[model samples]
Target: MKRIIGTGLCLLVLFGYPMTVQSQTLPVVQRFVLNVDYSRFWQNDSTMYIEISTAVYPNLILLQQDSLGFHGKVELNISIQNKSTGAMVYANRYNVPIHLADSASLVRTGSIVNNTIYALGSGEYHVSVIGSDVLDRTRKDSSSFTVTVQNKPDSLALSDIELCSNIIESSDQKDVFYKNTYRVIPNPSCVFGSTSFPLVYSYMEFYNLNTNLMYKITAQIVDAKGNVKKQRAHLRRFSLPNVVDVTTLNCISISSGRYTYEVILSDTLGQVKARSRRPIYLHNPNVKAASAETIVTARAEFEGMTSDELAEEFRKAKYIAQSDDNNTFEKLSTAQAQKEFLEKFWTRIETEENGKSNLSRSSYLGRVSISNQRYKSMSRAGWRTDQGRIYILYGEPDEIQRFPNSGDSKPYEIWYYHQLEGGVQFIYVDLTGFNEYTLVHSTKRGEVQDATWQQLLR
Candidate 1:
């Protein structure tokens, strides 16, 4: 007898049992067998891929006039093994049904499957396939194959990975884009206990559909002002098999502030593929407290100075102000306005007050008077000069180097500080050949380049 076993249906049949004496009996035989095939196997430096195919075969079976629709089920199992060691590397199982229509004259192709492995060292790999016939209810048919992983050339330079944080994708969308998922790590050596600096790091990855590996990548860090903080680049002649973990990027010491990190990927010819941005916040409570202390100490140092010293410092501040503005202080229209402005300015810089003991307020006013006496030019007081403003805001610098006019060398002065964060330096040049000095450049921690004073000259 025969039975049609369609999808979602199960069938069971039994032939006649052996007869008693004088009766004839037919032998029982299995009706179905299973088979599996692995058509292809290949490997890169660190991974291997396998393509699989499966089928089933019919065995001898007793059949009657109605035995025209016999059908059976088959189960398939695939696995990868290390030929050197007898251990199984990977395995998968699948179920398939064989219909009567699939006779020896007509075999059907099975579904194709692909698998991936990561971080595998170069070596020989083995793959095995096994099949079981549900009709015979036995694990009878099986097959096996082998694959080899060869070492890739060292010419493939694996670049460092960058993670970009807090990158807003578009002007309209104030949120970070899905495409931007780079991460940055700060420098551990520069990190002070409980002190945070404005810093960021970034990384990214790309894939070449043809070679199935990454091609090129780039990463950078920038401040809120759109200045480049740091940058790195990488290029690959041939495609890599898959993603790799590169070294982390670091940012220099910065104050507590907001920052953006960016990662970019492209082809060898510089065709952009993917881009991402990340935002990060560094917070250090101790640094904030220290900055406040610095401001207080600066104010006190100015108040404690002797009158002669104060006068000299005030003269310097005035010289700076007058040198820039044609020796003119923007005049106050009324005495009351001047008085009020001075009061507000002094109050902003004052940290404490004890009635007559308020030295901060007293010393600041004294400096203003001295500036007026020493730097008064055609239209303004000495205190209004560029030099005057700097001296009044920050105390006298630790050192000053002066260079008098000589040939093409212009008259210039370099002021240095000893204990400031990243140290401080200012260079003033008398570009106009006048007696007045003009601020040319300011450097903080040997990194920041401030040309605000240069803008005045221009």
Candidate 2:
């Protein structure tokens, strides 16, 4: 059987900042972006496992020519100390590598995910991770986190809730986070869109289920206003020591907003056993007026495309097009006129960057692709989403901080751009329980920067 685990999905990306090094011999101050997720797994009655996965950015290190290829690597040294006694419990080291075949690969800023497992009893341990860029030993970063492990209780209980992007039957068990004869793909962001994902899949394990006793399970989709939109309840008996509850909820008709999907477990006596809630964002299409840029009657190569495809591109241009541009496109009588409008549309966003016109167009289209990949929610394409609009206008963010199901706040994310129109940040919140994070506020001029963003988190 395949199993999945979770604490909460935390994504931390580093920005350029200097921090002091612990060692006196190393005078260099370095910045590191690290993201990690830990989940407790029961291996047996006497043993438990803590799975730790770490993602690190390669731009934070220096690359050097090696026999295999040009590579940048980091040595990860971890130490676990007993929190109660302050005694060392375990220590280990692993090397993480990043490789590039050409010097032009310097622009790559992707992350490398590495995993390690540790066995411990039911107690608290302080885990200290020190990462050193192998090519430049002076550049190092350190962070510490605490983990508590415990043996599965003999009584009825539920495992930590895991929100997944995909849960499917596995014939060979190829995925790491597999359990109960299935492969579970976790959505660390916990954001879902209708076009890309129409259903929300959740998984949890019920431990110590009695074969003779009946259990009641309730799953609810609740909005931010404390209203339940959809619900499912089931009563069943289990004969196994561990029974996995996998629920798939249809989100097709759900409106866009911030909401929560909660699972409640109860016994036949009406006593609550275990309950878990996860935040979700739903995205619905929003209507907007077209731009009004002066119409350029000259035809362009885009005229060769089908009308549907041309209309889609114009719809995407809604972000950058002016009101007049919108009016002009709407007024266009021929496909040739629409193509010319697109030519001027791209030209309007073009700049004298490193590659000029082609570069600007390429860059804009690239943002479109990324927006679709990262922010597209149910029912709407990524380019039509709010985040997609901002990304196309402002390019990549310098820093991204995501808070998923944290505290009293709804699932939200903050995007910071150090040099955009004088240092601005965009805040997005999933006000509805679907996975679409609409822009709640922004620091950029002329954009909606709500002063009451704190209240929206609830």
Candidate 3:
């Protein structure tokens, strides 16, 4: 049996799942990411429709090979309970396999999106979801949410707006939330950060609309103080009995912080009849990771460092830093702002790992030190080198296969990881005969992959 890492109540799971108020003491699991969202059914006034969407990060799932290419299995469980009566109202359990074009994409930063639809009467209920990797049973994630179902008779109403990290058109393979040829990937946390997710996609349904009447749909990103920071408006004629509206908003330029994405429906008289809101968090990738004291300290630890030294350290964090982050850091006018950015970066990662101790920081720095000592070349430092980067990002490989001066090919090496996303391999080659090995290919998603890599040996 494989060793399972249980995440009882990590903050990431808490943000995405919203399980009952009960909290757990287990550390956060960094292996996988989960997202959940819901859409309301409008066809029947007496019966309320609630469709829940769930997505599993591809990098975290374990995949297997089949005639179709590569795929990973995920076991899912979902349930809804009446909060007032503590009665179970809806429940379901199923399994899904995510497929990819090739092995290298398995480490990519996308997700396998799946949605489930449930119809129930008007009431308040708690929704719960659990997802486990079938091949790696020890790795599982779950979430719980509170929802209400209410459908009034023949009235002009709008359902809750579904927020998504991604939305695309699908040609085949029907699933729930497939409307007008588009599939929406839910962003349960409603948080967009780093560079991986820079767009916010929204979808909603409007019912009992007078097709002849003109209405305005407005979306705004507001701060906690009730001030609108960003807004967009759309004027439409509800020609159909029911209207499904979808919109895409650019969030890459949004500042890092807390905010809410709200949608409001208004008539010609400028009266707000129906409105829905979802909380959102924007992360600033430019923030660097560093050690510092709170305000109590007169001068910060990073305050004394020179600009060149600070830039060098931040550069070493390339494995985790985003392109936008580097661009932002380069434009900073003052050292204080740079220090503050790094502080936030470190704090965010620390929060993700559970603030129980400084073990995460120590471990990462230790790996960096090892990379420098073992993989550094004539031009680059250890962490900056290809071999150093792989070690720092994934830790030590389970096995290393070295092929020096074999046949007419250049010297090469293969690193195997037995416990990462099922299993993966990384190949490095010394193309220049200078002992500096470059990462030629990898079997992990998001990493470089070349099926004809053997040809490069010459």
Best TM-score among the predictions, by candidate number: 3
- lDDT, residue 106, model 2: 34
Residue 174, candidate 1: alpha-carbon lDDT: 22
> lDDT tens digits, residues 182-295, model 2?
766555334444533567778787777778888899888886457787788889888886878888877656654446889898987879888877566544323111223322
lDDT of 1 by residue, 1-458 (tens): 11111121111112233223332222324323222322111234444233333323332222111133334446667677778887776666755554443232122222111222223345677766666655444435555556665554333322223232222223432221222232122121121112222333333333333364445666665654587656778875445444432323445343333345566667777887665564543333223322443221223444444423433443443422222121111111112222322332344436443222333656655666665665455555667765655554455678989888666677778788665555778777776665566666777533336665544333
Question: Which of the predicted structures, 1 or 3, would earn the higher TM-score when compared with the native?
Answer: 3
Q: Which 10 consecutive positions of candidate 1 have the poorest summed lDDT?
A: 1-10
Q: What is the TM-score of each predicted model, taking all chains together?
A: 0.24, 0.44, 0.53
Evaluate residue 191 in candidate 1 and report its C-alpha lDDT on the 0 to 100 scale. Answer: 19
Error of 1 at 17 (Å): 99
lDDT of 3 by residue, 163-265 (tens): 7766778765454545657766666545565544566788887788887778889988886458776788988887696778787777666555556789988
| Order of the predicted models by lDDT, top scorer first | 3, 2, 1
The candidate scoring highest on lDDT is 3
State the displacement of the C-alpha of residue 117, model 2, in Å, after optimal TM-score superposition.
2.6
The Cα error of candidate 2 at residue 168, in Å, is 2.9
